[model samples]
Structures are given as structure tokens and as C-alpha cells.
Target: MADKSSNASKKSFKNIDDTQSYVHHLVWLDKNIENYTNQQKLNQWHELDDNIKLFSHEEECINYIQKQNDKNTESYIIFIISDSCSEQVIPKIHNCLCILAIFILTTNSENCQILNYPKIRATCLDTSDLFNRIRHCIYRDEASIGFSLLNKQDSTDAEPISLETKSNEQYPIRNLQEDQARFLWFYKCHNFMIELEDDDRQAKEEMISYFRIKYNKDKRILKPIDEFEKESLQDNAKNAIWWYSHNTIMFRSMNEALVSGHISTIYSYRYIIKLLCRQLKTLHKEYKKSISNNRLHLYRGQRLKLSLILLISNHINDLISLNSFVSTTLEEDVAKKFCLGRSKNNDEAVIFEIDIDLNSEQNIPFADIRDVSRYPEEEEILISIGSVFRIISVNFDEEKELYRIHLTLSQHEQLIVNKYIEQTFATEIDSDDQSILFGKLLFDMGEFEFAIKYFENRIRCLSDHNNHYRPTYLNNTGVCYNQIGDKDRALKYYKKASDIYKETKNQRGLGACYHNIASYYYDKGDYDTALRWALKALNERQQYQLEKASTLDLLGCIHLAQRDAEAARNNLQEALRIRVKYLSQLNTNHPDIGISYFNLGKLDSKLSSLIDAQNNYSRAEQIFRHNYPKTHPLITEVTQCLEQIKRQL
Candidate 1:
């Protein structure tokens, strides 16, 4: 039996490479794993880590650990072996670099302890003791918060982005800095959570169903899930903080999903997220009225990787946003103890000293949750997710052997972001629905894949095929496909939207679809077909000035392709006049206006008006450079045109 088990283990771990995505893995090897009927014992094991992988053979487990080492992945493995195979398996996997610790599950732990394997951290005869020891190891090794830094220079240099559909493209160009884009995306998501409306019973049932499927075998978690479902029949929002503070399935799953940025998981857990935020807001209001201090200081301690420490050190004056709900304390010693705890070799202990100004009119909320907390003695202060703070200073505490980072609540960074959001969305795509707004924001940020998924989800939820927003969703999905270079799929969705618009007599939707079709034909070099669609779009869009301008721009491009310089010039100039007059009222540097200037420059060059061409090209270059990255295609093309005109002069 032992030899057969060893052979099965070797063959089973051929696919061990799939576990690379996990930062920490738990591997349990017991020959009787299939026959193990101890539900309570299994529940205790799962509490240590929900994603435990069970194996019935020792050889397979050893191969899995060796494979992890071979890949040199940045992950640690906790290995648990039954007594029957412990002596043989420990000697094989103990030397593997990825193995963090080894546990011997035995009937006689005292006898096993005499083996003296340096990697063996514990010899456990019972599950409770084993759970405690493993929990400590996991916490000590992986105690950190997820955060992203926005350099001060990057934010200061970021110009207002223009969300104009450029010529020969189906969607608008986006060039926001990467960090700024993520920050705004999450901020929008937070707002969406607050505004989302769903039946509490339905949302809670959905959440419970999801976890029940995940932990079908573990009764420890299932019991709480059942209790939560029963308690949710009452006032769930009032107890949201208690559930969040308690180390249960809700707390673990939500935090893990938030830190990993798993969109699907977060959506499944939205009910709890919304509940927690709403409760926190109410508490924040009352807490503000009760406090008399003009300023308050808070501290949080954790171990971070050296790479993250260096990143924070290098960007001292920049902005940082915590990606999850942050827990801090008013007592410095409590926080200090957390940092001073055991940490991995590549980690450094750090304490975050956060200052809050009570007088400032900041939108982000934080509250003392002692009254509603699961552990009130801890005196926890919970800061809402997506909170932005400025890194005031960072210093090393020589005597304490740790680093101290100073952060202060600031809305200056958010103010800059607000301008960009207003300019990008407020003037265009005017929709009050938060879901639509968030989907469009993702599309504008060049997150085509995410945008596609979001639109599809929205479409599925809509019951009416002729719903007012159906055409919009279909058209946006098509545009996302086009951006990703899928022309056939793009055209299919465009035609679907066109059919819906025609049936519903939504003139505006029909006009947008016609413009998209024209753009598609224009890209294919079908000048006559492109002209026909552009004219149809113009007829439908006459009442909408910006939409009319877009159609005229398409007409000018088609005429230019047909070698009618005189006709192209007429159309281009008309388009330019309308765009300048309308867009100046909103943003002077709108990219649609820049697109007009570039098209006119091409027309002037064809007409041999060199000086006129130079002026138009120069204007286009200025706008493109300000609103886009230096390497953007528009900037590159305009720069090349200027160099040619200069040489001719």
C-alpha cells in the first residue's frame, strides 16, 4: 500500500505548476484523507487557510513542493503529513526552499519530536493545537496591506484627458497615468456600491449561496454562514461592523477579494460591502459630533516586503491609497507590537502614523467601531476603503529597529481627480445610473476587457429586450471589441444595436450606430459606402451638435480619401467651426478639436499650402502633446508632419 501511494503521488503532482498564482499554499498529505470523517477537525484545518489542497499520497505532495521550488515562485508552502509517511516525506521535502514549515500529524507527538527535523515546526496529536500553531505562522509571514502609490509629479503633470472618438477609431483615446486610472476606477466602484439598489434578501441569499458552494465540506464555516443567513432576517446593516471585525468567512473572503482586485468576487460580496459602508457613514456622522479634538493621531503596524518599503521610501511626498479597509489603533504600543512580531526574511517592520484633521471638509470617512466591534478591547478605528492620504514623511526608528511613515488625510489629490472625471464624463455620456457611469469609465480608461465583461453583465440583468439602454449597452460592447482589434465581432454587435435602435425609433442611438458603421467602412477604405452612412448619421444627428460634428468629420475623411481636396476642405472647416464653438464652452483643449486641426493640416498639405499646413499641424501638435503621452500615435504623427513641413520651408 505504501509503495502504491508513493507511485500515485508522483503522477498526481505533474500539474502542480497551476498553484503558482497563490502566494501561500497549504498541503495536507494523509493516506486516510478520503476516509477521514472528522468534520470538526477538518473545519479547524480550514480556518488556518481556506484554500487547502488535500492529497492522499505522500509522493505526490513531495513532488508538488519540489516543483514549487523549481519554478522559484515567490510563494511559501506549509506541509502537513500523517505519521505513517512523515518519516519518509519530511526527509524528502525538508530541503525544498519553498517549504516554510512542516507538521507531523501523529498519535504520539512526543515520539515524533525526537526526530529533530529542523524544518518541522510542530508535532501535533490534535487539530486544535495544530490550528493555533499554523495560524500564527500564516499571520506572521503574511501581515501586510495592499496599496498603490501615485507620485506627486505624476498627478501634478496629469492633464485633463479628452474622450473624443478620433478619426479611423471606434472608441476614444485614453492616456491617464496607470496609478491615477486605477485610483479613479476604484473610487468610482466605491460610489457605485453606495448607490446600488437590490433586495436585501436576494443579495444576502446570493452571498450565502456563493460561500456554501465554496465550503460545502467544512461545517465550521458552514455553521456561521447558516447563522448569518438567519440573522440577516433582522437588521443586517446594524451588525455589519461586527461581522467584518470577526475573523469569519465573511471577513476573510471579502478582504482577500478586495486585496486581489478580483472583480467577480467583489461583485458577489457587494451586499456586505455596501452594508459596511452605509453603517460606517452613519457612525462617522455621530462620531464627528461627539469628538472635541481638532486633530487625532492613529497608528497601524505591519510587515511589508523590502521592495514595497523602498517604493514608499522613494515616493515620500506622493499619494498612497489603501486598496482594502484599513484597521488602525489609537494606542501606539498596540500597533508597535504588531510590527515587532515575527516576519519573513524579505520583510521589514513598519508603523504608519496617520494624522486626521477634524476641521477639514474631507469626504472620506473613518470611525471608532468599539461600540459595535467583535473585539472592543482592541480599540479599532476602521478607515473606509479607497481612502487617499499624502505621505507626509518617512523615517527609520533606529532605537526601535523599524521604519515610521507619516500620513495625513488630504483631499488635494482627489480634487485633481475630480476635475478629470467631470471633464471626461459630465460633458458627455450623461447618465445618472452608477452602473452605466462605471462601465463607461472603464471603457475610457482603456480597460477594454473589463469594460466588455461589465457591459455583458449589465445586459444580462436587463429583462426587457427593447429596454431604453439596451442599444447603448450593445453599442458599447461593440466598441470595446473594436478597440481590442476584433473587427468581425465589432461589426456583429454594431448591427445588433442598429436593429434595436431602428425598431425602438431611438434616433440618437441609431445615429451613433450609423457613425460607428461609417467609421468601420472608412477604416476599410470603402469611401462611397462610408459617405452613404455618414450622411444617414448626419440626418439623424442634426439636433445634437456634437454628434453632428462627428458625422461631418467622418464626411471630410471620406472626401479626402476620394481625392476631392476642395470638397474635403469644405467639410473639414465646417466640422472645425462647430466643434470649437461647442467644446470651448466645456473644455478648450478637447481632443475632438485637435482631430479637426490635424485633418485640416492634411488637406492643406495636399493643396500645397505649406504655410497654412504648418500652422494647423503646429496647433494639433500642441493639443496632442498636452493631452496625451509623448509616445501616443497622434502626437507621433503630428510631429512627423511638422518635421516634413519645416524641411520644405
Candidate 2:
């Protein structure tokens, strides 16, 4: 037999428990079962009839997981727990979707705590509301962590099901109704995991054998798509939405197949590179056509073409580096499709230095004074940082083992005239005049500590003066503190900035500070305070459409937290309208616009506006489809929402 450690190193399962083909069974234990063996615990809930493996200890289970190195091997987890200890243990193993939690509890009140976990379905020896709630949860499709979608049938429901405890706050569980359908179906077959006193042994074995076959039939048949097939689909793709769905599914299948050591997956990925190259070529042609037709002056058209070219280039680079262990054949085949950073015969070449004078069109030649030698010696030229140059030729030097690059000013295009001036002793500094430019630059670059230092220096330079820049610096410093997770410090800075902005009558600054404060309170679950500040920020930001839209979105969230559906819908819809308008003006869809639509969709779904919700969800899906990869949370979220909506319709 092969060494277990060596086998573990070869396996590459991307998401083990996430695949729907896997089965999840919940096993429960009495809170008093203190020192039972793993087998004893499992035996208390499940019958030992099928091929299911059981381990007594967590370490033994982990080792078992490590040894299942074969790509085709199935993955699953079992949690044997009592009611009291479940909350502590479940969250640790919650990431494994294939795992099932069996809660050994008898009362409906105890079952309420388990409702916070969507994937968990409890079965007691005695009858309880747990079964009925499971049916209701499934019917509503609320098995995921998020707000429950509104259903008219639930009008008489007393209160919104709060997932966490009132006394000790914890993460809320989103109820996914779709999960109910699957779990309910599975449960009806097996009835319960724990063997009952009146249970028939022969019948239990039959049920176990029946479930194993049912699980295998549930697996989705995914196949790797070839380059020609993908190209054909791309050509037929009506819009970005079409491409998004196709690429997402195709890549996911390819990923799964590749991780399993499938040789054909490499060919599919190679085809993806070809497609990217084709896209780049098309963009290049459009750019050239625009230039020839004298239409390059159209900024949007030029920008679009350039953006597409850059996007394609980025995709190509990403694909090439995706797998470090790519076979030699695949690497060589992909390399043949592109020509870059390689030697080409020179039509004409020359070496020259930059002519710094703005009025001069000609460059200066480097001093070459080796007339006695077979070839003239090359002279080194010094230039400041950010100086632009054009390469004419690149010749390899045999003696130095380096490529001697030749360049000239006229051969290549220059995007910008460098304007960087070195900060040195020669440049005089004025201490009294405060400037936040360095601080702002550092903040933009994410150097928060250095940015804080610069902001402090600016404040010191001002000698405690109340200037226009002071509030801006304070507000930005607060933003840095918030990003670095020092909420107390962030709130303090925001308060100071707010005071300064109000004193100076700086509406924009005050609005931003209010928004920051609202965000802080929101994080702390102080919805009332968040709502108050959000309203103020929104009122102040009426003239700033984008910022106003953001504030409106925040207001929508606060309203949702307060369980005021009508107010949430109004705020989210307004945010969506403004975001849509913004994107329309730019003639492009943005991820933020998609998020606005998604928020509106969630609110609409909650109000039982199924058609409106579906429409908004479709639009959000389309936007996310084009802008982000399939794995992006937004894309998956919208996709999942759409699936639930479809079932409802």
C-alpha cells in the first residue's frame, strides 16, 4: 500500500462538503452522556448497517479525512452532540456542509435554539413542533443565514424568528427554505437517527440501503467543455449574462475535473487562453479602426476598447499562472499562442538619450569613442526616475551575458510627461503652512500608520488652528482607524471631525462624518443610533447622488434590522434608482449598482412582491455576471436568490 502521507499531499478537493451529492445526517446525545466512546455516541443515534465510517475522537476523524486522498472518494462529517454543548461545537464544524448535527433534545423550547442553524434538523424520540417548523422553514426557503422572505401565509406569525439569544448576542442564522425541501424529504424516509425501542431491525436496514442509492442518484453529472465547444457557445452568447453563466459553469466543471487529475481539463483551460487572445485581438482591431476613422476623440469608445484590452490581458496572465503544477505539454501549447518578450529581427535600431528640453524634438546620441575596437563601446546614460524611453532593438552581449537594449525617443508612444520632483534639502519647506496632501496620499495607499503621523504633523504645523483642511484630515484619520478595526478610536476621531465640520459649516465633511458614525453604531448593533445618523447624512448628501445612494442603502439596512419592511423597501428602491441613473450616465453597469438591485430584491422578496423581486434579482445577476467571477459572493447570492424565487413562482 502507498504511504498515507504521500497520498494526502496529492489530493486537491476545492470544496469537500459543499457538493450537494453528499448526505448529511444529524445524531443527537443526551446532555448527561459524559464519557461515552465515539461509537457508543453514534450508536445512540444511527444504526450500524451501511458503509458509513465512525471515529471516537476528533483527531481520529481528522486523520481519517487526511487519508481519503483519492479524488473520487466521498467526503462527510458526523457531529454527535447534546443540546448544551452543540452551540459551542457546531460553529467550529459548520464550514463543512456535508456534516449533519443530531441534537438529542425533547422540548420545543430547546429546539428553538437549533432553529438558528439552518442546516441542523433535530429529531426527538417524542413528537414536537420541530417537524412542523421544519416544514414551514422549508416551504419558506429560509434555511440560509439572512432575512426571511415575506410570505402572505405567515401574516399571523407572532414575532420575527430571532436566531440568537436576547441576553447574549450571537450571529443570526439565515433560514433557507430550499434546504427544508431536501431535509424534509430525507427525514421522512429515515424518520429519526436514534433507534427506537419499537423499531424493526429488518426495516431499519432496508431504509439505510434505500438512502444510500438515493444519495448516488442525486449527484449532478458535470462534464468538461472543450475549446471548440466553448468558442461556439461564446459566439452564440447573446450578452454578458450569457457569457457569465457559460463561463461560470464551464470553469467550475473544469476546476473539479482538473483537481481530480483529469488530463482533458488542461486542454479546456488552454482553449480559454485562446478565447482571451481572440478577445484581445478584437479589441486591438476596434482601437485601430477607431484611430483610422478619426473617431478616437470619442472618450467613451476609446476607454471601453482600452478597458477590454486590459481586461483580456489580465485574464490571460491569470490563466497562465493558475496552476503551478501544469504539465509540460500544456505549458508549451499555451506558450505557442502568444508572442511577447521574445527576440525579433530589428528593421532599424539606434541608441540615444532623452532630450529634456520641452521645445526640442530630437534626442542626444550617447558618446561612443572606441574606433580601434571591432565594435564601438556603449556608454551609460543617467536619467531621473519616471523618465520615458522607447526601445528600438535588443541585442545579447556574449561577454557580459546580458541583453544590450537599444532605444530611441521616436520609436514608441509616451503616455505622460513625468512631473515628479524629488523631495530634498534643495526644496524649501514652509512649516507654518499646513498641508494634508502627504497624509491623503498615504491613506490612499493603505499606509495608515504613516498617514496618521502625517496627519498629526499637519495638525502640529497648523498650531491648533481651525482650518478647512483640519476636519478633512480628522475625518480621513477616523476612516483609517475604522479600517484597522480600532472602533473606539475611530468613533473618537469621527466625533472630533464632526464637531469641526459643523463649526466650519462644511456640509460634505459633516455628512461623511455622520455616515462614519452611523457605520460604527451599526457594527455595534445600535440600529436606532445608526438610523438617526444615516438620516442626517442622507439629508446632507441630497446633492451628492452617489453618496446619497450609499446613505439610503444604509438606511434600508437599519430599517430591516428594525423589521420595518415598508421603510426598508422605500429606502432600498430609492438607492437602486439613483445607482441605476449613475450607471446609465456612464453607459456601463457597476458592481455597486448590482448590489443596490440585490438589496431592493431582498426587500421586495420580503414584501411578497415575487415578480418585482425576480426582476430585480435577474438584473442584479446580470450585472454581477459580467463584472465578477462566478465564485464572487454577489454572484452566488443572486443566483441562489433566483433559484428560491423560481421555486416560489
Q: Indicate which candidate wins on lDDT.
A: 1
Q: What TM-score would each prediction reach against the true structure? A: 0.68, 0.33
**Tens-digit lDDT track for model 1 on 1-649?**
1222222223222212211122567888999986542676666666666678888877787787788788877667888888888877788877676777777888886667557665576677876556656765565345345575655433334443333333433111122343354455566666676676644565688899999889999887788678778884456888999877665678677876776654556767888888888889889999889889999899997766444455566566767778778889998776764554233444556789999999988677799999998557557889987787888866666577677888988773453444445565553543766777777766655567878987887788788744677778888899888877886788888899999889988888899899989888888888899899999999999998888988898899899999988789889999999998987666665667888999999988888899999999988876654454344456778989999999998
Scored against the true structure, residue 127 in model 2 reaches a CA lDDT of 23
Candidate 2 deviant stretches above 4 angstroms: 1-457, 587-649
For model 1 the local lDDT of residue 290 reads 88
lDDT scores for all predictions? 0.72, 0.42
Clashing pairs in 1: 9-60
Per-residue CA lDDT of candidate 2, range 38-152, in tens? Answer: 5654442342213444443444544443444222233333344445555555565544433422333443445545446533545343423332222222221211111111111
| lDDT, residue 452, model 1 | 94
Q: Which sections of candidate 1 miss by over 4 Å? A: 1-143, 153-178, 199-216, 229-234, 262-265, 412-417, 427-430, 485-505, 565-649
Candidate 2 total steric clashes: 16
